[model samples]
Structures are given as structure tokens and as C-alpha cells.
Target: EDALYQKLYASLKNRELATKDRTERNSMFARRYPSHAQEESKKQHDHFSLKAAQSDASVEASRLRRQQHFTELASIMKSSNESRINSASERARHHFATVQGEREGKWSNTRQRFDEIRSREQEQRDQIAEMRIIHSNELSFRGTKNSGSISPTSTLRAQTPGSISYFSNNDDETAKTGAVADRLISRILKAANSGKHRRPSEVGSVFESSNCVSSLNTSPSREKPREIDDNATDKTQI
Candidate 1:
């Protein structure tokens, strides 16, 4: 009985030692390797971090794209505005040039018309001056001789080889006629020189004076008196 008790106690002690060693070995392995639940939690954390980083990158890229689009739009708008302004400026210049050209053309035409009228007036004045000179010379020539009675009121005689005298038997009538002729001639000359037009009444008076002088020239006249011719022959004989 004593042997059996000893054997039984030994057996119990061995079993306890064996159980303690096995428990210590299990603790060591647990410390050396992580649990499945802990690894899964760590992987989830890493995945969340990567997803957040990717989202940030996407947002930055979107911001860049939007900025580029805005810049391009601004450039296009600026170009369009400049083109419109240039077009407007060009149109304005063209309109101004057209208007100015038309005005110049009108002014040139007006100037040409004015020059034509002035030239025509000048030509008329020149014709009048020539006519006056011719009439004056004719009047001097027609006054040079007289013998037979022309009219009861007037006579013409030689004053010198180159000159003549004309007078009326009535002194008042002669003076009046002479004064009228001189006044008419002076007025006509003044009007021509001053570029003034004469009234029809005044022109008619001048024509009347000319007709009177022409009538005097047309009247019968002897070449010389008979007494003067006889004296001239006697002088030649002497």
C-alpha cells in the first residue's frame, strides 16, 4: 500500500509539470505572432488612408482643370472684344473718308462754276471797252469838214490841218448838246471801268447821241469854199 501511494503522488506531480510547460509554450507563441482580428483591423486602416489620399489628388487635379478652362475663356473673350473694336474703328474711318471726299468734290465744282462766271463777265467788259474806243475815234474823224448848210442849228469847220470845230448857231443849244454828250461818254466809261451795268435808259441816250453825230457826218458838205480855192490858186501863181 505504501508503494502504490508513492507511485500515485509521482504520477500527479509529472502531470502538473507537463501542464505548466505546455501553458508557457502557448504564451510565447501568442506574443510572437499577431491575431487574425488585429491584422484585419490594421489592413482596414491602411485602405482608408490610401482612399483619402486618392480623393485629395482628384480634387487638386479638378481645380487645375477648372483654372485652365477659365484662363482660356478669358483669352477668347479678350480677343473677341478687340476684333469688334477694330471693326468699328475701321468702319468709322471709311465713313469719314467718304464724307470728306464728297464735300471736296462739291467744293471743287462750286469753285469751277464761279471761275466760269467771272471769266464770262470779264469778256463782256473787254468787248464794251473796245466798242467805246472805236466810237470815240469815229466821232473825231466825222467832225473835220463842213460847207453846205447841214441844219439851221449846227456847223462844222476846219480849225487846223489835223483838227476840227463843231458848234451850234444857238450858243445855249450847243453848250447843252456838248454837255450832254460829254456827260454820257464819261458815265459810260465809268460804268465800264467799274464793272457796273448801265440802265437801258442811259444806253438809249448814248445811242441817240451817236445817231446825231452820224447824221451830222451824213449831211452834204463841199470840199472847200470857192473863195478859198481861188485864193489858193493865186498864191501858187505868185
Candidate 2:
């Protein structure tokens, strides 16, 4: 191409040389084509910087997306874990409460049984003492009859001195005697119960007289007062 440009210029000026000096031509070519490689290199550098910036932006976007995803997943996992822990705690509390209730019920039942047994034993003791006093009173009443302080009318029995006989007739005097006997027994029971603390109904339970219709055949006053031996009164209560 340089040779072609030189020939065209020589033809235009009508000058030809077999060995032409190329200094001016070389200088002109150098001036015109100067630093094209450097410009291309600069352009390449700019392109590389642009590509690097784009790659960095893509990488930063991807990293941000990854962080966001991780944050959301972590939040979900944390919420799920907290919920599970709360559920477990609630179940444990319920189980603990159930066990506590059952334990309390068992303890209450056992204590109630113990109290019942203790009450029964105390009632038996009181009954035995009451029987002994009733026996002693009978002996004293018999002594009073023998001393003529009282006369035996309808109370005489074939078996024992203090024993009573049942009246075949339901006369007014016989009914009065039975009524007196009932009142006397009630008074004795009340006296025995006076020193103790109990429900009024429970203390009064013993005063419910024998069934009147069935017992009228053998009145309460007609009940035989036999001699009670030592320790026999306790057995009678039993």
C-alpha cells in the first residue's frame, strides 16, 4: 500500500526515480497511523472495566438474594422452633397438673378412711361405757326395791330380781311406763354425750326409740335387767 501511494503521487507530479527516498513518505505514514494499537488497547481496557462492573453487579445481586433467602429461612425455622417449644411446655404443664390432682385425690381418700376408722373405734368405746353404767343402775334399782324405797308391780320377772315382765295388755299405765323408760334412756345418753363434741344429729341418733309397733309386743319398760358380770357390759355393746 505504501508503494502504491508513492507511485500515484509521482505520476501526478511527473517525477520518477528508480531508488526513491522514502523518508518524507515514512514520516507522513507514521503521523497518520500513530497510536492505533494504543487506542485499541485503551478501548479494550474500557470494555474490560465495563464487563467487570457488570459481573460485580450480578455477583452482588446474587449475594443479596442469597442473604435474603437465608434470612427468611432462618426466621421461619426460629418461629417453628419457638412454637414447638411452647407446645411441649403446655403439654408438660398439663401432665404435671393431672398428676398433681390424682395425687391429691389419693391422699384425701386415704386420710378419710383413717378418720372413719378412728371414729368407729371411739363410738364403740362410748357404747361400752354406756352399757356398764346402765348395768350398775339396774343393780341399784333392784337394791332400792329390796329396801322398800319402790314397789315392783309390772316389772317382776321369774328369772331375776331386777328383771321385768312384759304386760300382755296395752293399758295406759303400761304405755306410760314404756314412755318413761324411753325418756330415762334418752337422758342417760344425752348425759354421756354432753362432754363430747359431735354433730347434734349424730349424738341424738341413739335416742331413736325401738320401732314402736314391733316393740309394743315387748315394751321398753319390759326389757329384763339381768346381773352384768365384770367386762360383760363391753361385750353387750359389741
Provide the TM-score for each candidate, comma-separated: 0.47, 0.42
The model with the greatest TM-score is 1
lDDT of 2 by residue, 1-238 (tens): 9999998998866544432445565456657877874576588999999999999999999999999999999999999999999999999999999999999999999999999989977886777576556645643443111111222234423235223332322245455555544554556556555544447675345334433334433345655644433433111110
Flag regions of model 1 displaced more than 4 Å: 1-52, 124-180, 193-202, 209-238
lDDT of 1: 0.62
Per candidate, the number of residue pairs that clash is: 0, 0
lDDT of 1 by residue, 1-238 (tens): 9999999999999999999997786566657765954685588899999999999999999999999999999999999999999999999999999999999999999999999999988887775767576446535543233334333434444444223344433445455445545555666677777777778887676757655454333245633322233222111100
Q: Give the TM-score of candidate 2.
A: 0.42
Candidate 2 Cα deviation (angstroms), residue 145 = 15
